[model samples]
Target: MLDWLTSAALHAFGAPTTWAELLGFASGLLCVYLVVRQHIANWPIGIANNLLLMVAFWHVGLFGDAWLQVVYVGLGAYGWWRWGTGRVEQRVRSTTRAEWWWLAIAGVLLTVALWWYLDRWTESTVPGPDALTTAVSLLATYGQTRRLVESWWLWIAVDVVYVPLYGYKDLWLTALLYLVFLALCVLGLRAWREQLRTAPQGSPAWSMD
Candidate 1:
């Protein structure tokens, strides 16, 4: 099964398109679509997407991205439970100013740390961008799980970088996937913004101060 998944399914843009990438591409699209609808199922489906992409990234020497998928698995599980328990409303809400500051600080720190590690210890060709996208992905995924309205913005930023980075790595299919993701992120942002504007006060939704 592993061999078949890693094997080339076809050729596209002069690169071998593997089954893992194809599956991951489909799951990635579905997962984001579910997320736009605020569906709880997105979490588990996203976990599956992570696993498939982990294999795809590993084969292409994107070690940072491969490890990121492992972390996303845990985060996805947590998100599943959080949404299931209804402890936090699935409605979109703005992050507090302080929360934004902390997220920004963490993103910067993680990017620098990942860049240093990947450059020093790994044979990664695009260590700088790999680390950047990995770090932003962590932050964005966490924000999405929290149902923050700003998470879509973060995803848009990551998708912009990912499209070119994957193309450079000869992951043309993955690059094209990010292009689709870029569009989805825009739609998600608009939808979430509308939700935030219309949510009633004193509802279960998290309030912005």
Candidate 2:
């Protein structure tokens, strides 16, 4: 079963596309489409996408990204529960100044730390970009769980870097997937901003808590 899943499904961009990559691509596209529509089902679909991409990335020796997929599974579960809890205050909102500061600091620290670790201990040839994208992705996912509108901005940044990065790694299908994610992130940002604009006047649009 593992062999069959990992075997080449087809050729694309001169690279052999595996069944895992194909499945990951489909699920990932659906996950982001659901996210743009503000549907809660994106979380579960994202978890499945993570599992498929983990195998695809590992096969290509993108160890950092492969491990990132494991972390995504945990984050996806938290997001699933958070979105489904029916909390009145869990509406679309801007990130508070403090939250922005914290996320910026975390992004910098995580990128540096992951770069060092991946360069020194891992076989990743593109450790710098791999680490940077991984850190940004984690931050974006965390912000998404809180329903913060800025999460889409971070995703947009990551997707821009990811497209070329994956292509360089010969994972053409995954690179194309990020291209689609780039477009979806833009739509998601606009949709969430509209949600915030039309929210009740007294409701918080920016939350410090």
Candidate 3:
């Protein structure tokens, strides 16, 4: 598994091109679009994006990120189903501002644990940054699935860290893509906030603004 994954990364990193970068770029745009629009289709599209990124990052030996995409595939599917079922959104469970502190603490603890294990026990090169991104992303994905309205904040924080990390790794295209994602996170937050405000508590469907 290591040999195959490593070889793929080497091949991709060796020849990073406009087309490969654009695939990532376009997917990022579509994801943010669907997210801001509150469309259930976003998850399936997100799954596709993750699969593309899995190959792209794997070829570059960003093992943590590469593997992260694989996990996202599952999460994306779960998110899609959760949204489709209309349970969480119907609940309209907005977290208190205090919950943000809890999410921060959780993000920090998870990042520390992953960084330590991946760096110390494994042969991960950028484990600290990689694990941190993955941890924040986990929270964001969970929040998103549950329609908790806090997901965008988590994504904003993650995107800030990701821009520099991807740039340092010479994933210039991805770095640029994240800039767009940062903006989208802000938009998504506002959009979802409006969604929650007008939506009747315990109602299932959101009206388009």
- Pick by lDDT: which candidate is best? 1
Residues 143-194 of candidate 3 have per-residue lDDT tens digits of 8887788788889999999998887777777887899899999988888888
lDDT tens digits by residue: candidate 2, 1-209 = 67877999999999999999999999999999988777788889999999999999989888889999999999999988777775535578899999999999999999999999999999999999999999999999998888899999999999999999999988999999999999889999998999898988556433322
What ranking emerges by lDDT with the best candidate at the front? 1, 2, 3
User: TM-score per candidate, in order?
Assistant: 0.95, 0.94, 0.82
For candidate 1, list the clashing residue pairs, or say none: none
lDDT (Cα, 0-100) at 73 in candidate 1? 100
State candidate 1's TM-score: 0.95
Q: Give Cα-based local distance difference scores for all models.
A: 0.91, 0.90, 0.77
Q: What is the C-alpha lDDT profile of model 1 across 46-122, one tens digit per residue?
A: 99999999999999999999999999999999988888888676577899999999999999999999999999999
Point out the higher-scoring one by TM-score: 2 or 3.
2
> What's the residue-level lDDT of 97 in candidate 2?
100
In model 1, the worst 10-residue window by lDDT is 200-209
